[model samples]
Structures are given as structure tokens and as C-alpha cells.
Target: MSDPITPTPEPADADAGTYGPFAYLTAPNSVLYRRVMRVLMVEKERFTVHVRPEQVYAGVAVDGGDAVTEEAVGNALESLADGRWGNLLAFPDSSRVTAIEDFYRRRMLFQLSRAGEAAERALAQYDAALGTRGSLQSVALEDIVALLITLRHTVSEHATGATVDAALAHQTLRSLRERFVELADNAVAFMGSIQRTIDLHDADVEAFLAYKEQLVDYLERFINDLLVRGAAIAELLGSLDAASIDVLVTIAAEREAVDAAPGEAETAAASARQAWLRQWSGLTDWFVSTPARESEAKLLRARARSAIPALLAVVRALHEKAGGRTDRTHDFVTLARWFATLPADGDRHRLWRSAFGLTPVRHLSITAATEDAWASADLGNVTPWADAPPLEISPQLRRTGAYERRGKAVRVTDRSVAKALLVDRARQEAEQTAAARRRILTGGPKPLSAFGVLDPESFRLFLALLGDALAAMGPNPETAQVHTSDGELTVTLIRTPGSGVAVINTADGTLAGPDHLVDIASAVDEAAGDLVNWAAG
Candidate 1:
């Protein structure tokens, strides 16, 4: 008979060996022995069952720095099938499998690196979907909530698995967090886009509905992640409580109220009711509102003030809807009272100005009648209308020819009037110009002749004439100065120890110095003769 066939014992009883989720080894030679033996013995069966053992054995043999034999290969296959290599393949065991796992982990990291681009594409798709009217037709708050849930689930799953290093692990977690945040942000952005598009489409009711859907989506997530999460997240969520929900609710309710109306009167009544509801709702909605930080409070206040124009616009809309006319004077007084009670020096100024219709004055004009009345009135008797003259002329004025005046009174036509006005205007303009000039002149620490407005050429000419005249004088020099007063002109010369120079000043002066003075005098004499010649012509 052929040698008794020693059937390969089934893998189950081959090791009767203990196994664990992770692998380990003994000690000393166990370190190297287990590392070599684990891949050679334990992994062989799994590899041979799928493919050739030699193919898998080649990698282990190379790593173990050994030559493989058929017996060794068979033993490795048997041990792997029996699961007896307990401590041998433990995570502590640095083997080719660990390297393979590392390779795959790196690959996952590379995939994750592209996640941002994927998210961007997803966001673009979402935005495109929102832009279409058909996509919004049956969309509801529940749909957005469902989408968020899906996103959260997908991100959470992707974060799992030990296939990443510490750095990659942290990156993965951060990516997940950012993805959730982006989802929330995108939901908000999509809602806003939808609302804007609807508003442009002139579907106010639809726009309001879209806004309500956004609020519901945001508030649900806010309440869930913030209120249900750990204490830290809860605290963070609580910080967002200051956001005014009533504004959104009021907008929706107003639209609903108007849409539900059967007639104009009913619409008006509904609008009035909505207004009252909004006022109370606004107060109640913010009752628990507190900023997380002083800076946040400051920012909120600034933003609130910035929104005053929008608030007033809404109020005006509601007023019109209610068929109630706005009384500007009453509104101004009401606003003034409100502003007076506000905390000083916050963002209240902008709101206060808006509410009171306080606008920058572009131009101002005082009528002649108003000016005259102001002139006649005593300061102690001044009132709002104190400068407003009575329309009807007084009987005393009729007898005085005040009513029969052909044109403006002599007081208005006096030459002194124009002169005084001109002088006053000129003085004001001159003061302004001088102020600017002074600023430019004093801009630097030291003064320079270049800062002066005098033309360089003119100054050079005057200096040259002075130098020429000084040279003409004797060694003990005389300096002459010329000046004009009113219509008269004068030239004077004085001798100085160092030099003698001549200066000339003219009423309509073109040049200065002794040379110019002599030339000008000669020209005047010549002109007198020319005048006679021209008269003869």
C-alpha cells in the first residue's frame, strides 16, 4: 500500500492556540522570530488559498532576510490556518502588513486632501439646484434637515478606521468638522439665494416661505448640536441666542397675514394685528438674548444700529399696508424720545438719525423776508417761526409806502450792502485760503525760501537788480527802498555800512529795485509825450 496518506489535519486543531484581536510575541528571539515566523507561517495559508504561497512568501522572505524552504512554507501555511500565532502578529510586531496598512492609510490621506474640492463641487451643485424654480417648488424645512443628517452621517463614517496616523487623524476630524460647518453655512446661503430670487420674481409670499424654511432648518440644527451636545458645545450654542428670530418670524407672519386676507379691509386689519404681534414678539424673542462676549455685544449693537434703516422701511411698509399715513412730525418726536432714553455713545446715533429723518443739509438759503424778520425780532422772543414774516402786510406799512415799493427797498440797494457782502465773503475766503497756506508753510520742522509763493524768476530778477545797484554804489554803500501807499508811490535810499542798494515799489508793481524804479520813471515821462502825439493823431 502507498505510504499511509497523512491527510493535512484541518486548520482548526492545528494550534489549539489562543488568539486575540491584536497579535503579540514572547521575548528575546521572540521579537525577530515572531516577526519572521508570523508572515512566513500565519499569513501563508490565507495567501496560498487565494494565490501561490511562493508569491506571498517572497515578500516575507525578503523582509526576514532568509531563504525559504517548502517545509517552512508549509509550516507557515499550517500556523496561519490554525490561528496559533498569537503574540507573533500583534500590532507591536513590525511586519510587512504594517507597512501595507501604512501605505493604504497614506492613500486615504491623499483622498481626503481632495475632499475640499469635492465639497466645493457639492456646494456648487447645491447652489445650482437652488437657483432652479423647480427645485424649490416642493422643498421644505424637512428636506434641508434630511440633507444635513445625511452629510453628518457620511462625515462621521469617513472619520472612522485606524488607517490614519495622528496627523492624518487630526486632519480628518478637522475636515469632518469643517464639512458640517460648511453644510450649515451652505444651507443658509441657499435659503438666502432662494429668497432673493423669489423676491426678484415678485413672489413676496414665496420669499417669506423660503425664509421661514431657512429659520426652521437653522434653529433645528442649532438646538440639536448646541443644546444636545456636550457642555462646551451647548455653551457655544447658547452664545448664539442673541440672534433675533423675531425678525424672521415677523416677516413670514406678515406675508401670511396679507395672503390670508379676503378683502382690503381684512388685509388692513390683519396687517395691523401683525404689526402689534411683531412688536411684542420682538421683545419676547430677545428676552433671553445675551452676547457671549462684550465685543460680541458691541458688534451686535453696531449691527442692530446698521439695520435701523431696514426696520424703519418695514415699519413704513406696515403702515402703508394698514392704510395708516405716517405723520412726519409725530414720528420725529417719537424717535427723539426713544433716542434720548437710549444708552449714550453706542451704535444708537445712526438709528436715531434714521428714525428722526435727520439728513445732511446739502444747501441752505435764508429768504429776504426771513432775514428781515430775524433782524426785527429780539433774541429773547425767538421761536420756530420767529424768522417767518407774516404774509399779510400791516396797515401801518401801507401808509409808509412799504406796500407801494416799486422794487427792493433802498436799504437792500445801498452800495454799502454790496461792498459789505463782498468784504464779508472775501474775508471768509481769505481766512480759509490763509489757513491752508499756513498749514502748508508749517508742514516741516524748518522753513525754506522754496515754501514761499513768490515766483523764482521774479525773485531772481529783483535780487540781480539789487546786486547791480549795490555794486554801482561806493564801498560805503547806500540801500534805497520803494513802497506804495493807497495810490501814491515812493522810493527811498539809505546808506548801509556794507552796501548801497535801490528798491522800488509800485501801486501796480511789475518789478522792484533801483534799476526798475529808474526805468519806470523814464517810461512814464515817455508815455506823457506819446499821449500828446496820439492826441494829435
Candidate 2:
């Protein structure tokens, strides 16, 4: 440990100078003084009494430091006791001793004086101001309203004052002017405060809603009242005598009136009357001069009016936040809250696997075979990653960063067999279709008499032609067309009015009766429009 501050002589009867917060340590780079004060303050807090040098030193010094010298500690004590440097008082004491030699000897107990205490409190306030750096302090709407009412009353009172008594009028004019300045300055700061409050609390939905409620109440109380007061001020200004006052001559006369003897009553009364006029002139000159764009009342009225819409916007924003009907971020907040409700040690692994359609857990002992037969790990494999390309990683493996173990590929057992069978069946159907299409194209159109026998494909075509002929009897012919569902083939039907029946045989059955004579024409596409032209004609 270092050393304790030495005892100084008890304080003498000397007048002290004013000191502000931490004034003793306010010297240029007074690091030592500041540390001593902090230690003393802490000791006082812990013990709830005065601090002695020894207590101060024990708190200041760290363990395993160079031993503190007695002279250096003593100098700090002297500084605390000195009238110019210290804000503390050193009281002489005989009850306790710090050293073995002074066990029964006298010492000094030090405590902060009133000035020092005030300074320390000021320092705390300074720190608090730093923490919440002021956004223009809210102007009390009540204060402005009160000032305006009082000012209008003062102006009116001057008009009816005693001819020789200007004392109240003069004082009232000065007060009104000062209050108006304050109102204007604070009006600006108040607007800034509202804007800053909005920006700061925009994301804090609960606080913004709360503030909006209060702001609504605040505006409600003030807005209508401001309108009424502004009207009163304007009407009062119109009635005030703006022309019959001269300040310089009245000021000179008032001074002379103050010096007048008691016998010179008439002379004193005349000066007093002049002074009253001067007071009225001063009030009216500033508030209601000639050729003005906006009087003080008008400016104040505008301020009160503008504040309403700004306040409404803030309320509208808060209303939007409270009802999560518009903002996308509100949905995100809800999802985050749901995630937060999950237990810290919840079994998320199973949920994650099912949600993403993952395969059953597998071991790497039976890895899938690859086309490259040479793709095997090196002998010894001291560092497997040294020569390996980026691994074929599963999404789950990438997230968990698993390396020591891996999953085997899930075997697709039925897909290939099912796929091969579908391919063979489709190929057979396609070959038969190609053969049928070639016969239809080569034979172009056929009379019903020539169709003596029908193969499976041709019989299918005959059934389609029957459908077309029956559909042509519809009232809405535009919707009834002889085209396949995929629109690849168009069929045209003809009724030849023949005298005898025609017959055809197929492998499935014999379709024999259709002889009132029908001919069939087929076209594969719209470009081969033989059927389309025949249908149109």
C-alpha cells in the first residue's frame, strides 16, 4: 500500500471564496487532487462520517505499488486545508491516532464544507446532463398562455392609470417585452422537442403510443385556448394608443420629477404624466407599429396553428404502429417474439429436419459409389483436407459444420423402374401414332364406302369423326369444333347422301352401320388448312 495524507493544522477563522463543482481539482491537469477527493468521498459514503488522512490513503493506493512518501501525501492534505485551494475543513481531533508514535497524539479530521458539497452535487448533475443530452426542453403551454393574458391586461391597465403615476406602467412594459422574447424562443425549442421525440421513439412502439396520448391531451388543452387568447391580444392591440407616447423626453422628465421638492407638486405631476405616455409608447412601438406584415400577435397565432398539424402527424404515426395493419416490420417483430417463446434447450433438431424434408439419419460406412473409381482417400491421410476439393456438403452439414461423420446417400429404388416402364409404353404408343399419321396423310380423304375394314388407329379416327358430325348440330357452332383437345388435328365431316350402307371391321369390334354416307378429312395443323377451308365454305 502507499501512504495516508498527513494531518494539517485545524482550520483558522478565514473568509472563503466561492467554489464550483470539483473546484479544488479544477486546476490544469490536477490528477492527484481529483483522486484524493474521490477517495475521501467514497470513504464518507461507506462510513457515513468524516474521513481522516489514513482512510483516504488506503482507498487511493493500489496493492504492490511503490510505497507512498509521507511528504507527497501531506502536501495533498495541506492543499485541502488551504483557503485558496481546498473546499474541505480540517478539524483538530485528539481521540484517535494514525501512527504507533501518535496512538495518543492529536490529529486532524477532514470533512467537506458546504461549498464543496454543493460543487460535488453540481458535478453529479453535469454527468446526468451528459447522459441524456437535452433535446430542447418542452415549453409549458400554460406558461405561454399565462404570459399572453398578463401582457394584455398590463397594456389595458396602462390606458386607465393615474395621470401622474407611471411607476406600474413602466415596469409592466419591461416585463411584457421580456416575456414575449421568452415565448418566441421557447416556441422554437418546443417544435424541435416534438420532432426529436418523434424520431427517437419511432421504433419504441409502446413508448410512442404513450407519448401520442399525452401529446393529444397536451394539444387539446392548448390549441383552442391559444386561438381564443390570440384573438384577445389582437383586439387589445387595436385599442391601445400607439401614437401619443415619446420615450426619450419622458425619461428625462421623470428623472427631474424624482428630484422635485415636495412643494413643486404641479411640476412633479406633469413629469409623471409624460413618463406614463413614454411607457405606453414603448409597448405599442414594438408590438404594433405602422406598415407591418405580421404583428407579434399574428406571429404567435401562426406558431400555435402550425403546431397542431405536426402534432397530428405524430399521432397518426403512433396509431399506425399500435395497429400492426400496415408496417411489414411488425410481422417481423411478431415472428421474433414467437422464436423467443421457445425454450432455450428446445428440441429444434427434429422440427428442422421434418420442415425441410430431410432423409433419415444415415452413417457413412455405406457411401454411394461414384463413376470415378479412383476417387478414394490417400493412404495414411494425415491431413485429408490438404488435397481435397470442396466437399459435396448437405445443407444440414453446412449449418452444423459436421466433418468427422457423414450421411450415406438415400437410395431411389422405385423411380428408375417406374420411369423405364413409362418410357417403353410411351415409345410404343408414339410409333403406332407415327404409322397412323402416315396412313392418314397418304390416304388424304376417304368416302364412307371405301372404309371396309378399320385397324385400331383408324377405328379411333372413325369414332372422332362421329363426334364431330353430332357436334355440328349445335346452335352455337363457334364453340363446337372438330379438333383434338391439344388442337394438333382438325377433322372435317361430309354427308354424301348415299343410297346404301357401308361396313367396317376392327380388331376390337365391328362398327358396321353408317351408310347414309359420310366422308372424313383430316389435317394435322392449321397451316395444312384443307379441313378449315372445307368447313368455312
Candidate 3:
């Protein structure tokens, strides 16, 4: 107030010529004011500052360049502890400080308040800078935006106080705004790059999902085809078993021998004598007409009568050759009587014609006793033979004549009889040939049931499914084919050709693959174990 309190000169190291309230406070004559300005400037930069009436007095004394004790500093600090300094610094009207002393006091208070707020804000900004120092280089776009907002606030706050130099404030705000703008641009660029990366990742993942779905579908179809093919092989084997042919060689040999005999004269005469007896006996007996009777009565009687004599003669010859009893003779009367009573007109005559050297005749009525009797009587089997009774013939000859007895006549001819036998034999041969053909064509068993086995349509579906699987497996060049036991199924794997890789099945035709035979066997065993457990459950 007095003489405007001119301050002392500034130190040589001070930045520039002082201006405003600080200029008056530092004049050489106003030692107190000069010391006060020095204390205020130094303290404001170093430690926390409080401005009160008592602290203001201390500041004026310290301005005289006197050394202030620790107690003095403490008293000054305590005096400014209340909030009066804050009110003065915040005074709304800038025109209130008319004098130099008033300007000095008011400006000092304003500088202190503004410096404190700037220091606090600077400290916060420094901490923020330290916390995000590395982050500014690598932080996301959102974090950069947040940092810019804080920086803007800090610059604005620092610009508010009148105590701060107008030029310094302008410079700081300009620099801060420039920094914020640069950071915001960098953040925008960073966000755009990150979004692009995310878009690429999404596209790749979607493609992978579609590929996986296709792969699964292919695998399912492949397995189904393998199973169907295996079943087809099994069905084929069954058909083969049903059609095997078995030839009766013994019957064929007997037929050959009968075809080899000599002359129509002796054969016809022997046939006529046998025909007459067959007609008379068949009319007399019903029981003797059956097939059972032919074997028991006619065949046994024939054997007893004809074969026994030869067998006895051979035994006699052998016994004589061995120097043993040769006089042991078999009773021929029992054999002769059995033959005499047999149904002459029965199937026995046809059997006799087949057994003896006689030409076979048509319409011989060998099917039943009554028919045979009528046929034999008409052909004359009911009458006696004119010359010798018919002699026993070789076992090779087959019966082949019609008989006449009394005035009845039965005509016997080779042509008609041969045709009937040929037709009968043809039927038998055809059946045998067809059965053999079926056996060869169908493997071994009967055809599978309509629904139980895989049909042609199902097989086609299986092929399609297998084709899909092969495509999904990515064009394997190797391949393998296998047949099932029943000769029905044929399984094929489409794989990398010439590659060692292959798909195979178990001996029982179960699907197995992706490994060697040994590995497939092991896998099958494991699968069987699982099946057993499932069955128990």
C-alpha cells in the first residue's frame, strides 16, 4: 500500500523479465514484497501452499530475504490451514484489484490456488500417463478414447485460472488438443483393423463347420454300404446249397446191362411163356399185386429159385476147390413152390420182363394188380407156355412184354414201350439237372426271405451311400473287394489306389477297417465285448 511496495531485482538465472503483479512484488525497495514473491513462487513449486492472513504476513516478512526457521514455516503453514485463501483466489471480479499491492495479493492468491489445482491435476495426469504408458502403444480403440477424454479435462482445468500465464495456458491447451486428436485418429485406425480381423475369423469358422457336417454325412453312408454288401454275399451262398445234384450210378449201370442183350426170337419166346403165368396168377391174388409184394414175393422167389442154384453151384465148386464138402444141396422145391403161387399177371410179370431177356412192350399195365392181370391175361400170361417153362435170366435184363392167355390177346412192341420209358427217364434227368444247376448258381442255401434280406433296390441305395462316403473321404485311390461266406455279398472299399491303406471286414462279415487285419481283429473283439455287455443290459 505504501509507495506501491516495489520489489527487488530477480536473480540472473530467472527465466524472463517479470510482468503483472509479480513485477511489483519483486522490486528492490520492497524487500518484504520481493521476499514474499520469492517464497510464494518457490513454495508453490516445491510443496503444498495455503494462503491465509497470518501466512500472508509471514510471506511479506520472508520476501525481505531473511532466513525463515522451521517454526516460522510451520506457523505460516498452520495459519493458512483455514479456507480464506481459497475464497480470495476465487473472487469473481478481475477488476477488484485496483492498486499494485492489491493486484499483488490477489494475483498471488490466484496463482497459488491455480498452481495447487494444476499440481493435483498434473499428478493425476502423470499417474495416468505412467499407468497407460505402454498401453497407449497397444491399447484397444475404446481405451484410447477414454484417455483422450481425461486429457481434454486436464487441459481445460489448467486453462481456467487467471494466475496461469495466458501464453503458457494457450500453448498447453493447444498442445493437449493436438495430442488428443492424434491419439483419437490412432484409436480409430486400431479399431478398424481389429474389426477386419474378427470378420475374417468368423468367415473361416463358418467354412470349417460346413466342411465338418459334410464329412459326418459321408462317413455314415459308407458304413451303411459296407453292411448291405456283406448281407448280399451271405444270401448268395445260401442259394448255392439248395441246388446240388446227386447221381444214382447203380441204377444207371443196371439200365446199361439190359440194353446189351441179344436177339428178338429167343427174347420174344421167353417173354411169351412168362406173360401167360403172370395173367393167371394176377387174376387169382390181390395181395401179391402190391410193390411190397413184388419185393417180398416175386423178387425173393426169383432170387430163391434162380440165384440160389447158381450160388449153391459156386459154393460147391469153391468147396471142391478147397477140398471140403461138395454134396450139400439147397432145397429147390421151396423156391419153386413160392414162384408157382406168385401173381403171374401182377407187377411181377413186368418185373420178370425187366429182370429176364424179353422185349419191353407198351400198355403192359404195370401200375396195379387188376390192370396187370387184365393186360397179362389178354397177352396170354394166364395160359401154359407151348415149349419149355421160361428159364431164369441174367440179373441185368429188364422186363418188356405183354401177355396173352386162352383167347385173350395183349400186343407187345418195342417202339411204344421205349417211348414211355424215355419220357419217364427224361423227366427224372431234367429234375436232377435243374437241381444241380440251382446248386451251382446259388452257392448253397435257399433264397432269402423277401423282407429279411437286402433287395436290389436297397443295394442300389447302399451303393449311392457308399459313393457319398468315398467322396467325403477325399478321393482315396486304393480299393479292395471281399466276398461273404454264403456267396451273396461282395464288399468294396474305394480308397487310395496303390496305397497300403484299405478297409476290410471280419471273417463273419462284420465291418472293420482303418487298420491291418490284426488290428481289425482286435477291434472286432472289442466290439463283440461291447455287444455282450449290451445284451446283458
Candidate 4:
């Protein structure tokens, strides 16, 4: 083996000739250059750092077929090792030379340079990003909650002047930030991919349906998890006092700044503290709602819910495509099949005429006299055009080309009575609905069990309010508040601690569930203009 090639320092900008780690990517012989580097890198992984030119030629020939030759591989390796490109470190294979003539041959062993390896890895990462179909990570949410809880305890201990472990604080903060970033990024990516899937125009029907079904289920599961964890995270964040949080932030910053230079420790700590505060702000804004706008968690949930209807619409379109009610193509195909089954030319011609009715009508000028004469006559298929009797034409039609008497113009029907009845019925129903709202709002906030018996309309309105509140909450929530879709009522439900079930008797049946303190109020002040009159008929 010859001595390893000693790398030299890169030349100045003007002398470097614009060559870089990625220079070979745009070169005319980039394909062959990449293949040579690939073979060398693969060999390097196997602890064969130095590869003979013949081995490289063999690998390149296999992957690139008849395009690569031994001479071509040698030339590419030499070009890559030159001072300009510098993608490989070349060594002479002097041990294989038996005679001086053999020495004259440019036999060399090649090893991939550091820059070349880094470029390959970067390209590999790029390819992976292109193929990635990101997913909603519920586990990340769980991890974030766990971290916040730990930090809260840590802050409480520090507040009481207890010694805190700086290393642990740093690690916890780092991990929390990392997990939060992963959650936010993956959610954005997942939602984007879902939009693409929904906008699929030419996808196979069966395949798209299967994917969309599973996608909807996945979204629902994630949304539920998001609601529960998001609320918990927001509450935890609010529970931490600003002073306690500052203590933890300082501890983490000091821990991070330990690696800084002696004179720069204070400056580094200040920078780290600022960075930590910024990250905390980001985390807080993601889960905590404000007066300016809603939290990202709630927005993501709404987007996910909207996606369900869009997916259903696509499914409906696919269903229509598979089995349409008025399929003209099917009709034409069936008619063609019928024409194909006919035996004789005459029979086919007759079937075509009967189906289309587009035959010439030169002898069809009928008059009242001819119509009476032919009333008892046989004009069947056996009668040809030449044998058929002639029909008389009216003298007025021949002279003026018109033979009908004029009549009076028709009057438009009057629907005032029907319109009045519809208006009266609508007014009555709206009054009834208003009465139900008033009845429910009479007894302020109380335990569900105290609501007593209810009319059917009141019972239905109560159920609707209950459903809206529960849906706004997660699968298992202790307290929830929501405004009905009609913007007329706001409902709040709080689960009370007990083993008793709240029983509500309606005119139809008795309803029982976990006892909850329920409150229903009119949203007239907040949504006066947007209120909708929800009436059941």
C-alpha cells in the first residue's frame, strides 16, 4: 500500500475556481463522479477505506451498465482528487506494480473526502423529507404535559429556597422545547398532507376511500387527545407564578452557560435566558388562548373537523361515479347491445328507426278529413311508402302556412292565501321556540336533577345544548362551556363529585347520566345580530 494522501489547505477565494463540496453535482461528468464516490463511501463503511480503481470501475459498471469503463472511473477519480474539486483523497497502488512498465500505468486507490461524505448524507436527508408523510403525535402531547408538571414541582421547591439541580433543569427545559417543536411541526405537516389527499382528483376510488376512512379516524383520535392535553397544559402554564418561572429559567440558563469562556459566562447566560423565555412564550401561545385570537390547538381541532366533511364530499362524488342515477353512457351501451343482438339487416334498421324516430316525414301532411278516413285504416309495417294511401293537406296551410285560431293570454295564479298561511305558521312556531328558551333560562344555574319534568320542545333544546357543551369538551371532561351553533344560547356543564346520576324526565322518556351542574343563558347581549331562531316543526 502506498502512503495516504496528505490534504492541503484550500486556496484563496480567487484561486479556488468556484469549486466546492457540491461542485461535482453540477459538473458535466457528475454522474460518473457520484458513482465513484458512492462506491468508495460504501467500501469505507465496510472498513475498506482505500479502494482500488478496478473495484470502483466494477461497482460503477454494475450500477451504471455499459456506460462506465475502467479508464472512465480512473479519470473521474483523478478529477475529483484534483486541487480544484478535492472530493476524494487519491493514493498510488505501488505494491501492485511488478515492472517499470506497470508503474507507468495510472493505477491508484481512492478514498472519499470528508466533504463528499457530508454531501451524500445531506442529499439522503433531502430525499427522506420528500417522501415523508408526517403524522399527528399524541405521544408528544403527553410528554409535554409530563415535563410541565415536573417543572412546576421544581419551581415550587426553588421558591422555598431548596437547592435545585441545574443539570436536570436544563435537560428538562431542552426536552420540553424539543417535544413542543416536534408536535407543532408535525401537526402543520400532517394537516397539509390531509389537504392534498382531500384534493385528489384522479385517484383510484377504492384506494382513496380506504385511505380517507383511516385518515378521518386518526384525526378524530388526535383531536380528542389534543383537547384534553391542551387544556391541561394551559392550566399548568397559568398556575406557575412569574417569579417561580423566572427562578427555573435562571437555573437552566446558568447550567447552559457553564461551557462558555471565562469572560463570556455572564453574557452567555443572559442570551440563554432570553432564548428560554422566547421558547416558553411560543409554547404558551400554542395552547393558551388570548383576547386577540384562539389557541393553535383549538384552530387545529376545527380544521380537522372541517376536513371530515370535505372527505365525505369526495366519497359522495366517488359513489356517484360508481352508480349514477341518470347514466347516459349506460343507456347508450345498452342500446348498442340491443342493436347487436338483432338477426337481420331489416330488423336492425327497423329497431334503429323505432328507437330514434328520425325518419323523413314528406308524406305526413294530415288534415281533418284524411284523419277521419285513416281512423279505421291499417298503416302497419307491411305497407311500404309506395303502397300507402295519400293524405290530404288543408287549403289554409298550403295558402298561408298557418291554420290555428288565436286565444286569450293566460292569467298568473294568485298565491297570497298560501303565503299568508305559511307566514302565520312560522310566527306561531317561533313563539313556541322562544317560550322554550325562556322556560330553560328561568332557573339560573342548578343541578340537573332539580330541572324537574320538561315539555318535548324544552327537552329537545336541553339535549341540543348538552350535546354542544360535551362535544366542545373532550371524551372525559370535568368542566366545559360552549355557545350553541345558532348563537342564541350559551351552556355550561360542570361534573359534580358524587356517585349519584342525574335523572331528567321528558315527555318521551327518562334520561340519566353523571350528575352535572348545568347553566343555560341567552346570548342576546353578545350575539344580538347573529342570533338564529331555531324552531322545530
Q: Estimate each model's TM-score.
A: 0.19, 0.34, 0.13, 0.62
Best by TM-score: 4
Scored by CA lDDT, what does every candidate get? 0.40, 0.56, 0.38, 0.81
Say which prediction, candidate 1 or candidate 4, comes out ahead on lDDT: 4
Give per-residue CA lDDT, model 3, range 358-407, as digits (tens): 75555342335445544555344455564323334333333434343347
**What shift in Å separates residue 221 of candidate 4 from its native position after superposition?**
0.5
For candidate 4, lDDT tens digit of each residue in 18-40?
A: 33767888989887777777787
lDDT of 2: 0.56
By summed lDDT, which 10 consecutive residues of candidate 3 come out lowest? Answer: 242-251
Model 2 residue 285 CA deviation (Å) reads 9.5
Candidate 1 lDDT trough over 10 residues, lowest sum: 106-115
- Model 2 residue 498 CA deviation (Å) reads 99
Ranking by lDDT: 4, 2, 1, 3
Best candidate according to lDDT: 4
Task: Estimate the TM-score for candidate 2.
Answer: 0.34
Residue 454 of model 3, lDDT score: 35
